[model samples]
Target chain A: MKKDRHFYWRLFSSTFTLSAFTFGGGYVIVPLMQKRFVKELKWIEEDEMLDLVAIGQSAPGPIAINTSILVGYRMAGIPGALLTVTGTVLPPLIVITIISYFYIAFRDNHLVKALFKGMQAGVAAVIVDVVIEMAARIIRNRRLLAIIVMALSFIAAVLLKINIVIILLFCGILGAYTTLRSKHDARSSPDSGKDESCAEGSGTGGSAGKKEGSD
Target chain B: MIYLQLFWSFFLVGLFSFGGGYASLPLIQEQVLKINSWLTPAEFMDILTISQMTPGPIAINASTFVGTKVAGLPGAVIATAGCVTPSCIIVLTLAVLYYRFKGLDMVQGIIKGLRPAVVALIASAGYSILLTVLFDSDDYTFRLSDLDFIAAGLFAVSLFLLRKFKLNPIYAMLAAGIVGMVIYGFLPSF
Candidate 1:
């Protein structure tokens, strides 16, 4: 009983501290998470760290929150997920609440205005940087389909101004179709691919918390 | 009354805010500025600045700021809860089910498709933020004369620093603010 309580407390406090102190959003928090969980605590493996980041980024909402939940769930379960997520969001809720009270004062301040306008330009640049980095990673895969989808999606978003939700749905369907077709072709090939079912089975099953780059 | 609205609005923001928190800004702008008039354009910009300055994700920061502005302490709680709930639910469900279906070719394909789309969404989001900084919209039209060249130059310099020197974004943002203060606040440039 005592161990369980201690574990939960540690989980909450570590996540809370990480979220509270980290600046620059999700990307920044990721490395900190690696340090705390993989290095300091030894709770998760290095590769699992990457998987958590991948799943977190791919899912909805904030990557920080998603990662916290995943890490928590990986360690414990639903309760851990709840605890970590609460810890992750608490600092921002507190900080922004205080700022809201001072909103009028800050709004009318000349220095703050100039600072924010300048920061906005910097923020624009950061977003551009994010785009370049993400594109470069995708390009490394050398998948023509991925590249084509990325370009088309960019056009639809930037030029045509299509709705974002619709675009995601369309791409998801296309991806599933292409992948499924390719898998079918491989299975039907005369080579028949020995150990295919073994590979598929091992891929699906949880490996005693030792999952490492199944993809 | 307002609390419920805040929750519902942020709930929608959470649900559709894929890619990242930055991608959620348009949804936020639409709900808070256009649909409800909870904040004016200038106030919206302030929220954006605060969101960036703060530690959490922009979505959480924005929701908290807007909620507090709209209702108060309880408003902040409800709004943040709403914004975060969808993610929690979605992630928890996936955490349970994803590995179970991990080997399904269709599943991998769906994720593969979503990856490029997410990249596009992120790029589009950056473009939107850049649009606000680079161009001045007056009477619903962009004017070349209204373009702020100084801000554009700062943006280029910041991007260069980030890519070339691998500078942390916080420092880049701070440097840009300092430059802005020097030019707009002290230099007496029009």
Candidate 2:
């Protein structure tokens, strides 16, 4: 699908505004993204937002940038992705640079120190909220296999202190193996209405090949 | 030379920081604190607080902050670019191909499997920060005096406001900062 004449500008400006106001982190920016992309622009559906976030979370680097790239690519391909990522990253770079110039001057100030101490607590609390919100969503699926994978991953990540890349790699392989076996079994039976794989939401561009194996 | 170091340091941070910003903290600490000696542990905590108040991903905010301190505006630019380059490359490629292969059951399954792990990683990240802020040492030891009651109280109040009232965290952070000034900045005699 062809994009509008000012697609790049729209992509850049939208992401720029969103990133400029996004405090906390990825979860905080997501709802704003839904409003802008799903509601206002009609770029993608609500469920598709979740998929984009999931893809972002699974990928390396910050979820905010990853989501921008995904949404941008969906709207206008690679250039769109590049533009959005640049826009999303710009606010932090500019603001933090300004802050750093004064960091030394203020580092030893009593008021500043106290304020940061308090903010540390606040930041930690917000992180707790993020953890709870994410956990609740993941658990809602109620798939035993999924839960098991999560638990093992937790052990590997938090307990054993294994590298995150290793955990993700293993889980990716396991997911692929488990789902491939299930798909083989389902092929012999009558097709069901619920096709998890086909649940990916559509957008104006990058339709990819439609799922063709199952009727 | 320092610019290259800044670029390489943040580049690794961006590459390995999977899940989200918070989950990337340990990696950031390793690079900034352990390897580079750019910031001390206490200074790192301060910057982390600043990161939250600032508008951006924690990892990006951190890279910019450290980059500026280490070098200057150019350092900030290079570090920020380093931090984002991995995402740009990886996500752009994935976005191009994902929808094409998204129909495969395995792709869906992998996402499903990764969901819980992401939660776990996030939780662990949060828990570690919570411990550091609330307690004196991060040794997993429980001690009364070791606990910073003021910080702990602020954490409790902030968590309550965020989860129960669904308050925007920015306000809570601002409020807590004010309270911190009152308690730590002014009430030293008490």
Candidate 3:
């Protein structure tokens, strides 16, 4: 019973390094993981990377953490996912343990204060940069819809203090609707010379965006 | 007892976090602010700033910082472990079942629905944090004078240089920090 565990090892190694070295939290991890796992290693393809990001963002947990889980599971199995997540999480855990011992001693140091103050500005910049990258992807697909949803939600949260969960649900519904409708339109077109009209929205087979790479 | 509480609570957060850690911000905030009383809301923001400066998950950082604050080094260890243990458990379990569900229609349908919601959550997180940044302070006053306009002008220039021109964010951040310190030193109350 031989198993190909190299994929798992690679994922674990990459995710672990990513977790350890990442600065400014989860936002920084996404693109780094993308560059390493997708471009450097070629373990996952480009479109798949996009989809992976979408799912990782849409679900719960840390991006690197959940990504390791999903990608690990895909590559090997439950054990693989476990290994990958641990590999990623363990380094930071250890580093933080060490930092905890010494943070108090240097807590009031001028350089440390300056570093943190700089990071406050950098952290926001990083978040915005990542958001722009993601928004670029969505905008490429459906510019108007993406802008509308983004602007509307931005306004709602900024002005009305709407809940995040509620905003997410609304966007998810709208995205699905548009995606499904586009698929339906594609199928119903006379290009294939098929006269079939999608009668039931739920059971119709034209769900074009269901592909792993597309999601 | 505190360890157990942290473990159970974060385990639940891990299970329900469907889109990633940002989605769990509100939940984590509730636990830390309302239920646990480990850190005041203001303190939590400070921890956030610290966490962003360092490596690792925000939740994990929060856990460690709060735990240390509350119960020392031991508490930090417990909290950090508690924060991550759930994903370890869940991700491992799901890895086994990945193939069976990979091509499923229902799963895709559900995910198709989940995507936009995730976007909304991200946007909302940004917004929620913005409110906290802008309005949560005691002296939350805005003056529309020329000096203020100069600060705004600098902010815009920085935003564009960092965003459009692709200047390094770390540099931009450091520059802003320097500008902040300088402005404070000079104007004091401008």
- Among the numbered candidates, top TM-score falls to 1
**Given the true complex, what DockQ would model 1 score?**
0.60
Per-residue accuracy of model 3 over B13-126 as CA lDDT, tens digit each: 554455564556655665676567777545565566666556787777777777777777777767766776766665444333332233223334445555444455455444
Interface CA RMSD of each prediction in angstroms: 2.7, 3.0, 5.8
Give stretches of model 2 more than 4 Å off: A1-11, A28-58, A71-77, A136-159, A191-215, B1-5, B34-37, B98-105, B138-144, B187-190
Over B1-190, each residue of candidate 2 has an lDDT whose tens digit, in order, gives 9999999999988986766767677678768865788986567877788887789999999989888888988998899999988988877666556666554345467765666776776666566677778884443345677788899999899999999999987888888888977898876742
Which runs of model 3 end up more than 4 angstroms from their true locations?
A1-15, A25-58, A70-77, A100-115, A125-215, B8-37, B40-42, B73-78, B81-97, B104-117, B131-157, B181-190
**Model 3: per-residue lDDT, tens digit, A1-215?**
12456655676788788888987566678888789877897656665555555555544567767776766655455666677777776766666656656766775656555444433444444454555665666667776656677667767654665654566556666756766776578677765333222222321221222233222
Better of 1 and 3 by TM-score: 1
Superior candidate under TM-score, 2 versus 3: 2
Q: Fraction of true contacts kept, per model?
A: 0.73, 0.81, 0.36
Q: Output the chain A TM-score of model 2.
A: 0.70
- True lDDT of residue B89, candidate 3: 64
Best candidate per lDDT, number? 1
